[model samples]
Target chain A: MSTSRELTRCKTFIPGFDLISNGGLPAGRTTLVSGGPGSAKTILAAQFLAEGIRNASQPGCFVTFEEQPADIRRNLASFGWNIEKWEDENKWIFVDGSLHPKDEPVMVGDYDLGGLMARVNHAVRTINAQRVSLDSIGAMLVQFGMPVVIRRELYRVAWQLREMDVTSIITAEHTGQAEAPVEEYVADNVIILRNTLEEEKRRRTLEILKFRGASHLKGEFPFTISEDSGIILLPLSSIELRQKSSDKRITSGISELDAMCGGGFYRDSVVLVSGATGTGKTLTATQFLAALGEDERGLLFAFEESRDQLYRNALGWGVDFPSLEAAGRLRIVSEYPEVAAPEDHLLRIKKQIEDFQPTRTAVDSLSALERISTVRTFREFVLALTSYLKDKQIAGVFTSTTPSLLGGSTVTEAHISSVTDSIILLRYVEAFGEMRRGITVLKMRGSQHDRNIREYSIDSGGMHIGEPFRGISGILSGQFTHSTSSELQTLHRMFENDDEES
Target chain B: MCKDFLGNHVMLEIIDVLQRPDEAENEKILATPTLIRQSPGPARRLVGDLGEPDRLIQLLGLQDHIRPRQ
Candidate 1:
């Protein structure tokens, strides 16, 4: 709102879209939407108008050249958009440019979009529409079979829309992944939606290719089309690292572990519990979630185990998950990671956390989800979930199952180690030919923590962190070399001499 | 063709897209020599050359409006 002012933007009100677009599409201008077949380009265009009507109470016009108006009404109805009712209410209008099979127009000479333009103009005028969507301009391109003329006509149409002062979207088909359609030059703004199958998993992303006079977040942001909510973006890169740090500490439920973490973890920090199979990572997460105070609530996204299995496991560790849940202090959502895509899972998890208003959350074994996604997708998922929890100021404990049972890191830890505030490594230690479990505070941010690898035992009463392992070396590297007490004394002397020199 | 079909009875309104672009745009008159029934209960349109008088009349449902050329 200054003398040297930027173009006022028209907010689409699509979830996460406005945020990434830096306050929505440039107002009073047309933005070309390009994507491949089935990339939801039409949906995005229609949603530009639908969201305008539903959220801003702004009337909109839909000019379809590909699908008939009847089919559009029915197809978009699944999104809970009552187009017919909106049309009657004068909130939405459609200018049908779709040619019928029985009455295909005879092209004798030069032509223009004059008819389509007039219809759209009348439709907009009738409703005083603020938004317009021209879906799949590729159809018009095919109908004319002249890219030059079509592009020129489209430029005229875009200019006409600007004259109407309606912020609009014109969707065109992107022929391939690498090909840029010539029609994109019709508008100053461009957005591309991609639905790609990476590593046998479907991943959808939306990227703002160019904004002529506007600023926006760059790069492809992962998005998902929910059953009810259409397209939702996980704009993790937009999350600022500005969460206020809390000095208040909360226990890990295990006192020795708390002492090792220097009087417990920060109230709103994320902890990663990494372990191999049978190393009690879930137990660690359960303990972290179970330590919730009376007023505090915990939400557990159990990915590796079901509700009954988690309950039984917690019961075996002397924690009554059922009663805690019944008392409304805790909520557990256990599901198989294969049920949904990573983006969908993030949405569902975020929804659950929002609905429950939890003070802390534990996603037991995030490694389960890694199997269903590519490395990059899995990393983004973790980063997104971690940032969400941090932004909410909710403490989170996510367990990552390491592939190697004896010791060694996992792809999950490799990806998400920097995102989390602390990493609690659980390992299987071999001592005197006996399989013993060990726990260590690998790293803690902004806190003093014990560096010793302590022995821990899981029993009916749960895990107990005992003293640090003695006369052992290379436990972290999965190599167990036991040393005699005399050799340990020599090693202590060597450290003692080095300490004296320092 | 339309003159041969039913000449003096049908009133013709001609629009050159070059001349009245706004009116052409408003009426969606894209092609040259396009014919439209403006006052009919439902508007009927034919784009390009209106070939074959009988077929054009049938296509436009102009039987009632047609009288033997006066």
Candidate 2:
């Protein structure tokens, strides 16, 4: 043991989960995992047991009360958890407590789960199991109609399992009752899994409400279940904020914009470029990636466009993406947001960043990710992703779409700009009868930045930042009016204090 | 009513075999909704609905002393 606190942990090998649970579950204690249907509670319990077998060489027993043993085995086989092989080796035991009755009515108070407990005990004793999981005590509760009797039998089962000195996980279904379930009171630890509909998209979260002997993170954490990785927990609070500031700087790939951002964006800093449609957000992000040196690496996560589309579009800007890839300096990852949750997308990006070791990263637009989740969850996801990148000392460039073509206000701006280190606003300015693009440095932390709203154009030559929009007012409000030189000087003098405050 | 009639007529033990699957398997009870007359001589098994009181009483050899449903 590395420290005195390490004595009580069982160390479940699920990734990103153990850190949030202080270390792992309290050793030799029962954990209650209660959730609704399709919440992946069973998968988590199964992963706990499988990880024990594969990593710690600790034998386990799975007392299945809901699914048949063979069916469970076959279902878990899709996850590559070979239950049969482990069972055949005597290192694992599977007890089937499924009620296989044809039509027999289970009378109340008559069925005490004695038969099921006997089988579980036998299996545990045979394997000398170190871990045991009763997959859902709810199945038995339905058989024994009385809640008091079910509670008593469940407590009895939990006590018996504890007496065997094995770490146990018992699953329960959320009955939609006002009061907490009996299993929550009986177990040493309780974790709830929730699968909810938010804006017509499914969001999954895991929350550890109680741990008997260990301190844990005190809020709900988002998680996802991949076919390959059983249950991936994204404990955002587990990541420590990187407080050390970096003095180094990286280019924005466009020279004029870099000059406006006070010698490019600070190294390992997050920069947000907010704009409406057709405002060159993607082009600006790709330019940032193109600015990386031949040795330094960059990764672009294009949420809206396909890889080929980004490549073809960048070619129009006289940027050769294939050459950068050949030189091993750039990688573009395009993923469809409609298929998975935001956590899944973040996990994939984390994996790619870890493997590629990119010095700089870019998410072309966060609005697409927002479409896949609720606004609150998307903000959390963005915060975690940006913090993780900063901890790795990787400069990040993220683009967000404003709802109005005219720069009024947007949800993305209100939520994302606070988390980012710098903000650059791009808007459409109607000077006369024609529309033109204008750019401004809204905020840059830890350094001085250009406060002027400049005119910009995007064509085959990419974004060319021209001179600041002189003798013009209300450029960002979409109602542009020409002003005299004296009026421009007076206007600048009036907003000088405001610029300093901003 | 059938249970009441059986109790009034015969001295027998009624056990819900589902409470003990091992015991049920030991008795070679393969299907459910099954009634096994364990002792009066040789064991006989009757399967399906026992909702019909007269048919159940007759099948269990209790026809000699049939009671009306009160």
- Residue lDDT tens for model 1, A349-434: 99998899999899987989998988888888898999889989999998888888888889988988888999999999998989
Tell me how far the alpha carbon of residue B24 in candidate 2 is from the true structure, in angstroms, after superposition: 12
| Model 2 lDDT per residue over A1-502, tens place | 4457644889899887888887888887788999988998889888998989988999989877688789888888888889999999887787766655543342311335555566666678778999998888778666445677667777888888889888899899985458877677766789998888777887888889998757888888888887776888888756676557799888888899989988988888998888899888998898888888656899999889998899899999989998998888899888888767888898889989999999989998888988887877887888889888888889898998888898676677787677789988899987767788899989999899999999999878789999998777887776667998888788788899789899
Each model's total of backbone clashes: 1, 0
How close is chain A of candidate 2 to the true chain A, as a TM-score? Answer: 0.89
Q: Best by TM-score, which number?
A: 1
Q: What DockQ, between 0 and 1, does each candidate earn?
A: 0.23, 0.07
Model 2 Cα shift for residue A291 (angstroms): 1.8
Alpha-carbon RMSD to native, per candidate? 3.9, 6.5
Against the true structure, candidate 2 has what lDDT? 0.80
